[model samples]
Target: MAEMTLHTELPADMTDTRGLPGVQPEHGPWLRVDEAYAAQIARRIALLDDVPEQVLYLETASQGAAQELLHEALNIMPTLGFTVEGAQVTCPDGRKVDVSSTAPLEALGRCLQNDFVMMEKRGDEHVLTGAVLCFPASWSLAEKAGRPLSDIHIPVDEYTENVARRVQRLFDGVQVGRPLWRFNQLWYQDAELHQPRSATAPLRVGSNLPDGPFYRSERQTLLRLPLSRAVIFVVHTYVLARADVPELR
Candidate 1:
């Protein structure tokens, strides 16, 4: 939850692609946000209770990772002014968060703005054990829970031939201290952050620009937990008005 410096100024070269073309993830996946949008994060966290089914899911196997993630968040977000006293987390703005009273996964979700997905290794593939995905791109957290990586991405175009195998290999080779991230961009009809549309939702091509007022992008990062050997996937969603994004024109 450190302030994101990179996004302090609006990005200029944003695109407006509508198709799910092949993914090309960069080597180093973690992004540093220099500017902190405290109000937006607070708003998203507050909305979580109203959309529990759309936002959080956890399996028995993921409980340990959930706790570990909560601990990690408490340690990393100190710059955002978080104080941990025993089981309580106090935010910069004086909102007290009781970690012990809330579910581990939910506690982790509420503390940060980014949505998190916890993946556990099973044989050669990674399984989606748990998540707090309040701002889904175009998928359902409930349906993806407990599914393998490949199965979870079944609806994505060109996933099998283009991104699936590579993602699996990346997960297997990722080390505990090292983290990596990449970006995905698309145009959306609306600018809301909590989009839980199914994969079958119609694509909004550039020709359909009149209907889409927002240009959406996600900064996705992957990190491995040293203890649980689980991978934590974090997605920070960004939405810009089409008028603000020159590429949309």
Candidate 2:
């Protein structure tokens, strides 16, 4: 899986668990950087250029929200080591990306280390309207693109019917300013950044043992856009050698 790209160490104070607030209050800056920033961003850019169809999807109706997301990202990224001037943004890796594009989601995929997913409440449940997901853990964007929260997570045993209702409620209640975040830890045999497996296939994960060669964790943050009122799900993925995380041993 394309020469393992990983952070030398996981973030300090990192922990595991599952669920909606599985969750906590996220402070100021939504965009973040880590040791693997350059490599991960490079991987994202390559994925966008090579396989745009696999990584990016924007519904026709979600255009306005998508543009709004780009705007929001442009505003926030500057504070986190990104330089934004005019219509261009210089990422931490010294790569310049156009902040403005006909495809704003793709533009975002070019600039940020985190994979951004935009979900808007359609009727009874929120729909996965648009996303630039380069580093999916083991789920396909194609399979989960237009599906509702429950359907998107159908393969996950923890996402029960009752939990689904609670999560929907949490989504409905999450305010525009205050954002909540969470992290899930998993073990893996290898440290491939872009691991997208289709829903129909049987899963292959390395969590059966106490630990494995690598540890992968995704810090997922939930933000409500002030303009579109759509929820922005940000995933900052981290992978490290199993030996780097002392808590696991």
Candidate 3:
């Protein structure tokens, strides 16, 4: 069973209507270690341990990007108060994780709260080559793996043709170091975190209910790997009770 995970507040602005690629240039820190860091990291570690095949995927060719991702993460995390000692990183929650090159994505999964997905242009579109996606809102890695951005959002009704083309262009134009970000909020009765739904199956509950117990938001960011030219998709998920969510500022 998925654990009951909840955050105190939505990290980003939630007043805007949900739309395709409502992106803004990101200036501040990207990876966040929130109040739910300890619990969420524990959940992530448990998921990785219990369901490796289901939660993690690294294509043989994508190894370089994965290693670069780990290197990038290690560089950013120390600024967020994480301690790096040789090969091991001590998180703010005081948990120690090794800098495992052989399993760099797993190392990233262990330390960071955000899930990382590596996408590279294969022919005409960016494909989902690799990911350590433990907290999928309502999508599965098995189905979305190797699929392009347009195919990945097949189940999302709002992701139309124009939006897909625009998103592809955005992915193509995104530069290294300069990250573009967007946020999405949905109401859900279930806030277990690892909510992966297959493409074949229909959602048990719709995301647009007027009232729900939990408010789930994903702070999604896209950045390019300097060497591989693969776009790194990062998801920082936050779930808060309806009552805990503050009114729009």
Candidate 4:
């Protein structure tokens, strides 16, 4: 589990998307990166292959979804200044992304700015079967791969006792064409997106105070794929200076 810092006063409405000041809603959770963040997006995509291979996991069952996700990304990128010319994708910044050489999942992960996880139903549970997690907060992609939703979230304090059953029900009831989103905020000592902890590390519940200079939040969305019957979990991470956060200030 990622180290979390709980606020003294909770937001009036946890589901209020406008609770955070300065952060614009823009296109909502499932975002399309424009020219402004083109450089950063390109840098992260270039670094994807270099990150620990374990950060990406594609099960044999998820191959179709991976391909579908790639197609979906290709169709979505043009609106964000990414144009596909044959097998090459040209970004707004003039960077050419050739996916012909890489695997479908890897190519899709590199092409899009959002981190994606594919969840498939297995018996009574929906498992985290495959994912391309480039910017994990404090959780390890390798540790979470192939685990059921309940098991993956077991480390989250009170998750099992509180939200587990409801979440399972939500996943079971989720249908194609009806996507949902939720936001999660936490204080962190560092701004880096990849913050994997060792198995021996203890889970800290509150902020480390002055040492944690970053206020991190993730906009998470869930949508069911019509063809694959797999749920696509997309996470868009935002890290701001602690001083910049209205609540922290």
TM-score of each: 0.81, 0.93, 0.94, 0.81
lDDT digits (tens) for residues 111-211 of candidate 4? 76678889999999999988888777667787888989888875666465447777787778767767776666777766555666543467442233446
Count residue pairs with overlapping backbones in model 3. Answer: 0
Best by TM-score: 3
Q: What is the lDDT of candidate 1?
A: 0.70
* RMSD after CA superposition, every candidate: 4.8, 1.9, 1.7, 6.1
Any runs in candidate 2 off by more than 4 Å, and if so which? 1-4, 16-21, 209-211
Candidate 4, poorest ten consecutive residues by summed lDDT: 1-10
lDDT of candidates 1 onward, in order: 0.70, 0.83, 0.85, 0.67
lDDT of 3: 0.85
Model 2 lDDT, residue 131, Cα: 97
| After superposition, candidate 3 runs with Cα above 4 Å error | 1-4, 12-14
lDDT of 1 by residue, 1-249 (tens): 212211332343234343333233445324333344565566567667777777888888678889998877777766556778888887665778899999987886777667889999988799999998877777778778888998888766657655777778888977887776655766676656666766566754322355676666777778889899999888877766655555432
- lDDT (C-alpha) at residue 240 in model 1: 65
lDDT tens string, model 2, 105-224? 988888888899998998999999999999999899999999898798887877888888988998998898899887888788788888899888877774564456878888888999
Residue 177, candidate 3: alpha-carbon lDDT: 83
Of 1 and 4, the candidate ranking higher by lDDT? 1
Candidate achieving higher TM-score, 1 or 2: 2
- Candidate 3 matches the true fold with a TM-score of 0.94
Report the lDDT tens digits of candidate 3 across residue range 1-249. Answer: 334568777654555655678998987677878778888988999999999998999899999899998888888888888999878899998888877644988899999899999999999999999999999888899999999998999968888999999999999999988998888877887778888888888776446774878888888988998999989989998888878887744
- How many residue pairs clash in each candidate at the backbone level? 13, 0, 0, 0
Candidate 4 Cα misplacement greater than 4 A, ranges: 1-29, 34-39, 204-211, 247-249
